[model samples]
Each structure stands twice: as C-alpha cells, then as structure tokens.
Target: MPPVSSPGLLDGTGALRTSVEERAARVRFRRAMALMVMTLLAPGSAQLVAGNRRVGLVAFCLWLGLLVTGFVALVVALVVALVHREWIFSMVSNPSLLLVLRLGLIAAAVGWAALFMDAWRIGQPLSLRLTHRRAVVGVNGFLCLSVMGTLLFGAHVVGVARDGILTMFGSDEVVGAHDGRFNVLLLGGDSGEGRWGLRPDSLTVASIDAETGRTVLIGLPRNMSSFPFRDGSPMAEEFPDGFDCDGCYLNGVSTWAQDHEELFPGSEDPGVEATIAAVEGITDLEINYWAMVNLEGFKDLVDAVGGVTLNVRQPIPVGLPHEAHFHYIDAGVRKLDGHDTLWYARAREGSDDYSRMARQKCVMNAMLQQVSPQVVVRNFEKIAQASTAMVSTNLPASELDTFMDLALKARGQKVSTLSLVPPMIQTADPDIPLVHRKVEQAIEQAEGGGTKAAGGTGRKPKATPDAVTGGSIGSLSEGYAANQAEDLGAAC
Candidate 1:
C-alpha cells in the first residue's frame, strides 16, 4: 500500500508466501522424523499421539503386558532361587508352560513387527524430502527387523527348553529322599522301537549324598542272579526269597514283571518297579528315582555335546570286524563324534562284556570330567534335542535345581566309581553282605570330605582337564581316580 503495489514480481508478496509454506513443510518433515524415533523406542507412542487410536491402544497394551510379565518372571526367579530353588526349577521345567511361552513369544514377535511397520506407514515418508524420506524408510525397516529377530530367537530358546524338559523329565511327584541321599537308578537299555520292548542290558546306581553332593556310582552286572527285593515291596511279596528262578538274571526282572503285570496292581510302572527292586536288593541302596538312557540313542546326545573327549586304551572296532568301513579308534586321547563314541562305549570286539563295562565307565568319567557349563551353553539346542530323544526319567522337575547344584559341587570334587563286575563282586553269585559293605565303604569315603556346599564350604579348585584326561585307559583301574581316592588326580 505504501509503495503502490507493483505487479506480481514487483509486489514481492508471492515470494514471501512461498518461503513461509516451505518452512512449514520442513517443520513437518522434522516432526515426522522425531515421531519415527519415538516409535522405535516405544512402539505404540507414535501412533497414540498422531495416528489410529485403536491400533495404538492395542499395541501399547501388549507392550505393557510384556513389560509386566518380564518383570514378574525376573522377580519370581530371584525370590525362588533364594527361598526355595526347587520351585524355581520345577516352574521353569514345566513342559506345558514352556510350550505356551514359546507360542506366545512367536506371536508377540510377529505382532510387534507388524505394529512397527504400521508406524512407518503413519510417518508418511512420501511427504518428506527425498533424502529424509529414504533415511526414515531405512531406519524403520532396520528397527522392525531388530525387534522381530530378537523375539524369534527367544522363541527358539523356549522351544529348546520345552524339549529339554519333555525329553529328560517326567511327572514324578517329589518324594522325600531315602536315608539322607538320593539314589537314582540308571538303567542302560536298547530302547529303540521294536527292540523287544526295552531290553535293559546295563544297570548303574548313582547314589548322591543330599547334604554334601558326594556321589558313589554302584554298577550292577546285568547277569547278576539271586537278588532279593526291598522288604514289603510288591516284588518282594512276589518273589519271597529272591529273584531265584532258574535262568532269571537281574536283567530279566523288567521282562518278567511286564509278563505278569497283574502282580504289581499298585504299580503303574511295573517294569521300573521290578528293576528297582532288583537294584535295591543288589546295591542295598533304596532307589529314590530312576532314569533310562537308550544306548543307541546315546550317540545323538554325544554329538549334541559336540562329541566327548576320551582316552582310548585300545582300538575299538566300529562295525562287525569284517564289514566294509569297519575300523577302529586307535588308542589315544581323541575327541570322538557320535558314531565313534558309541563304538567306544559299546564295542565288544577283542573285549569281554566285563571289559566293555570298564571301558564304558571310562567314557562316563570322560564325559563328566570334560563337559563344562561353557560347553553346555554353547551347544544347548543340540543337547536339548538329543537328550529328549534319548532319555526318560522318573526324576521330578522340582528336584532338577537341587541336582544341578549338586552337579556343580561334584565337578569341583572327585567322583568315585565302583563296578560290581569281575575281580570285585561276583555277578553270578554276589555275596550280598559283602556287596553292601562295598557300597557303604564308597559312600563313607565320599562323605568323609564333609564339605556341604549349602554351608558355604570351600571346595578344592577344579583340576585342568588336559592334565587329567589323556592317558592309557588301563594305566589306572579307575579312569579318573588312580586306584581310589577322594581327589582323583592327586591320587593318580
């Protein structure tokens, strides 16, 4: 008005208006970038502020649920660990819950990822400048992927954990331990389908001292005969004197029980009960729980753990001596995969059953001594998968943590092994009193240390595996212990 407005260009009003509009566009782009950042940090926040209310509300609710769940889980785990660790193990090992958890994690992953993508759409990157728009698109995509990937991985862990619980754990109710210890009957069998219904060829009792975590491995020969059952047990009533029928060996107890399941009306697992009766009668240790590992299925577990390191004393043949591809794992400290480790543990070529039993003990010792927590964590998925397929146990999930703690203690201490085979206890005609004495002797020796982990008792530092593992197998009667000592390596 003052200068008498010139025509379009001279007026300059059009230019000023265009500049103000451009500034507003730039501000909008900046705000969009900020919103995208907020979305990345707190998924539903962007939508709740500037987009679809329903979607935002739902997304936010899910976020809150996950947050609360994670918090509660952490709190419960910590409290249970301090107050009653058994509950923690039991809850975590529950198969049904684990399955639900796995499915939920997968669903959450997909849902959250979808929400993130929606958030990107709401940002309306098309309205932004070319450079800013491209940048926003890239960030949004990366964040979506990151969130989804993490959740999916969590699902995998949950699945693996569920498999672990199912494979190894059973729904056995927790019963008080026997005689201040947990005597778990370990039965080695050919449990493959159509293998004559679980022919248990090997038996060992893993007697663990509840207080001290000290352990004694009492091996029973499958050919053992003339064994008595625990007093007042179903089997005891059936066989009043002992399992003394002609041609009846300890190994046949399960089959005999299966044939006459009517006798064990009170027992759901007649085979296990019969076997337990035989084991209890022979070892003189009350069986608290039991586990059966299929010998053929054991290779998968070995492979799952990335193979076991064994000191081979002699060449163990892989197949029938004459078959093609028949070879031997020559004597040495060797890390064997599943196939070879199986032969190492089961081979009968150039060896008697008793000798094979001794070798098997060596393999067990090697596995226990060499496998560490670090190794387990590294190959947890494989181990969980293999374990589920290979083993069945009557051990309650509630007791897993207790056993795990005991195992940790045992690793720091020396493990003792006693096999009831040739030159020790006569399998064909075992001297019952003497056998009991031997078992007592082993337990007494293990507990003599009196180092209760619960009391914060200090244990000897673990020995290096390298120094202890490689050697001639027959060089020591007990593979880990030289002859028999509380500390295995020191005695050697």
Candidate 2:
C-alpha cells in the first residue's frame, strides 16, 4: 500500500486539530482587537473589564473629566461668539488661560498614551496563535507609539507656551487699542556668547487697524537721532530737548537707559521703555506692545518651516570671509533654509545698513506671504520650539490670540511698508514731525486701498513683484529698496 497521504501527521485527525486551533485563534484575535478598539474609544475600559480595577477607574475618571471640560469650553465659546464676539476674544487673550490650556493638552497627551499601552497589556497577545499574536503585538505597538509620539509633541508645545509666557512677558495686563489701531514695536538684536547684550539693529512699528486687518510696517533707522518722547515719560524728562544727548542714536537709547538705570526708578524695563518713547515720539502713535528677537535664534524658526522661498536680488554672504568661511548666498528666486534665511535678513558685508533694512522688509514680506498655514502645521513642533528660544516680548500671552486673529485677516490683505531711511528724512538728524506725517500717510494709504511700493528716495529694485518678493526692497540704485512702497512686492 502507498504511504498514507494525509494533511496531518496523525492521518486526517491532525487536520481536524489544526482547524480547531485556527478557529480558537480567530476568536482570540477578535477579542484582542475588540479590547484595543474599546480602549481607543473609551480609554481604561479594557483594564476595568480585566486587570487592576483601581487604576482603570482613575484613568477613566480623568478621561471623562477631560471630555466634560472640552464640552463645556466648546459650549461657552459658541455662546460667547454669538452674544458678544469681543468677550470671546478677551477670553482667548488671557495669558493665564492660555497657559492652563497648554498644560492641559500635554497632560491629556501623556495620560492617553499610557492608557493605550495599558490596554495593550490587558490584551494578552501571548495567548493568541503564533500569527495572531504577532499581529496583535504589532497593532498594539503601533497604537502606543503613535499616541505617545503625538501627545509628547503636544506636551512640547505646551512647554513652549509656558516658556514664552515666563521669559517673554512682563505684565499680563492688556493695553486697549488707540485710535482704532494697535501699534507694536518690533526690535531685532543678538546676545550670543561674544555679544554683551541686545543691540537692536532693525526697528519697525506694526500698526494694525482693529476692525480691518490693514497693517503698516513703519521702519525706523537705527542711526536716527533727535526724536522727542511721550510727554512726562521718564526718558523725556531725562532728555527734555529730545533724545539729543551726546552721541545718542535710535538704537543707542536702550544702551543709554541701561547705563543710567537710576533715572528709571523702579521701572521694569527701562531700556525698552526709553526705546518705546523714542518710537512713539517719531511715529506719533502710542506703543501698545513691544517684541524683541535674538536674531541668531531666528534661523531655527526658519528651518522649522522647512524653509522659505524668496527672490534673492543680490549676492548675500553667509559669513565673513576673513574671519571664517565666506559663502555667498547666490542671488535669484531660491528656497532658503534657516541659516540662509537668517543671513538674508542680516547680511551686510558690502551693503549699507539702509539697504539691509529694505532687504529685511522683503524677508518679512516673504515670510508672511510664503509661510502658509499648511506649512506651519506640518512643522508645528519645530516652529514652536524655535519661537520660544528666539522671541522675548512684553505682550502678554493672552493677547496673542487676538493678534493671531488679526494676522489671519491681514494675511489676505497687502502689507504696506514705510522705512525712515536716508534722502527722505535725514537719519542722522531726522525731522520728527515730518516722520509722523509720513507714517500717517502710509497708514491712510493702506487703509484706503494700498500704498505705492515703498518708493520716493528708495525706489525699490526693478523686479517683477509677482508674489515671491512682494515687490523689491530695491537695490542700491533704487534708493534703499523698501524705504517706502505702496506695494512691497511691486517695489522689490
């Protein structure tokens, strides 16, 4: 007789055994998936049904509390938005509330991830068939890893928010809008190892209309001097004849104030206050908030967004050749990473400070126009981290939401720029009153429709302002590129 040909070693009996085992494996697999799914939907459910009841109950309670909080918050916001939009804005603008929200998000992330892992442990994938066991293990690992990664990232964001509030803010109190516009002073400086302290090179006032998101970036020259101050302010009393003290320049105000700290008397930030006074006097606008950035850290932010695309009109050197490797950032429409972007915003080898000012505006415009919301979300974690390290501001964290809302509105509109550089107003001895008129004109023009490319004196570089440059800041011949422009892109 031919050797018995059967699927199982013990004739057909083994085949039946194999089939029974497979059926049992299917049941186990289904149960495991079910537990995992339940844990995902109602965290801690699997544990409560199986393992440590106390731990499960606590986790479930915590999760329920979070859900209830979320529901309440959503309902409150909706009601507030319908009844009074300002109330909603105010609520979101509170620094304390924002800090709480950030921390909450982090807590939720960590806790949820832990619950997912616990659910996996309760699954007991080892009891499953070899194939089913592997599958269960893989799925549990994937879910736990995914939840942990996402929540941890959120926790990082919350940490960033905390740092931002702690290091950047001074007073949590918000200053109401003035003349329907909120004017914020922007200062860019560096305080790396070799540097002593902040020496703000770039100065601009972003005056935004509350109702309409129309904005005006009024650039002030660092070298400017002889500007007045807000009446009776400490700096004004110190230098009654304008900031006309010996060797005083716009950028020097902060240093001068630091040197003469006694003059401030119990003030929080004398240097910032002095600079604000100078800007207010020049622009004839009240400064509501001020933000400062250590430009060295800006590169990290740029990299976080992957990179920004810009039209490099001229060759920008990355570093000094004599001191280190001199690499020229080749000109043209190119995508620049953080390092290159920082250089683009700060490079001034053969270029004058005024020209760099114009270029800086162009970079701003590029970043504003180019860095889309999608890009921000895609690189949210990195951006949040970089922002915390780079920026320090007196604007309370609560007020950020209000600005963010305005920013969304302003995104669609044109951003008019007016740089107070050479030819139009003498940087060395600027006529304060005339400067005010120029700023007013720029704002009025922007609100009406749009301003001319920051033209007059600094005729912007002759480039097609198709989107990338938002107009030219201008080359040397075009004055200082962005000294003044109705349309920055067109001016560039």
Candidate maximizing TM-score: 2
The TM-score that candidate 1 achieves is 0.78
* Model 1 collision count: 1
lDDT of 1 at 188: 86
RMSD to truth, every model: 6.9, 5.0
- lDDT of candidates 1 onward, in order: 0.72, 0.76
lDDT per residue for candidate 1 within 1-492, as digits (tens), equals: 476654333354544334555676688777777776776677678789989888888888778788898999899789878967656656666777888888998988898788777777777878877877887788878887888899898899888878677656766688677878888888888865665335587787888878767777777878888888888888898888888899998888988898889988878678888898888877788888888887877899888888887767556788886788798798777899988988877876665665566566666666777778788888877887888777788887767778876776666767676666644556677888877766777777677743433211122222344323223223222232322234433332
Candidate 1 regions with alpha-carbon error over 4 angstroms: 1-37, 52-91, 95-100, 125-142, 163-168, 449-492
Model 2 lDDT per residue over 1-492, tens place: 757755434664444435556677788789888888777887888888887889888978888988898899899889877856656766644556767777776677777777777777777777877888888878877887787677776767656656655666656789989988999999997766854234687899988998877888899989888888888788888878888777889898888888889988897778888899888888899999988877888888888888888878767888887756668878788899888888887887767777778778877877887777688778766877788788878887667667776776787877878888766788778878778777877877877843443533224445444322312344444455466776666544
Model 1, residue 136: distance off in Å is 6.2
How many angstroms is residue 367 displaced in model 1 relative to the true structure, after the best TM-score fit?
Answer: 2.9
TM-score of each: 0.78, 0.81
- The C-alpha local distance difference test score for the whole of candidate 1 amounts to 0.72
Pairs of residues at least 3 apart in sequence or in different chains that clash in candidate 1? 167-388
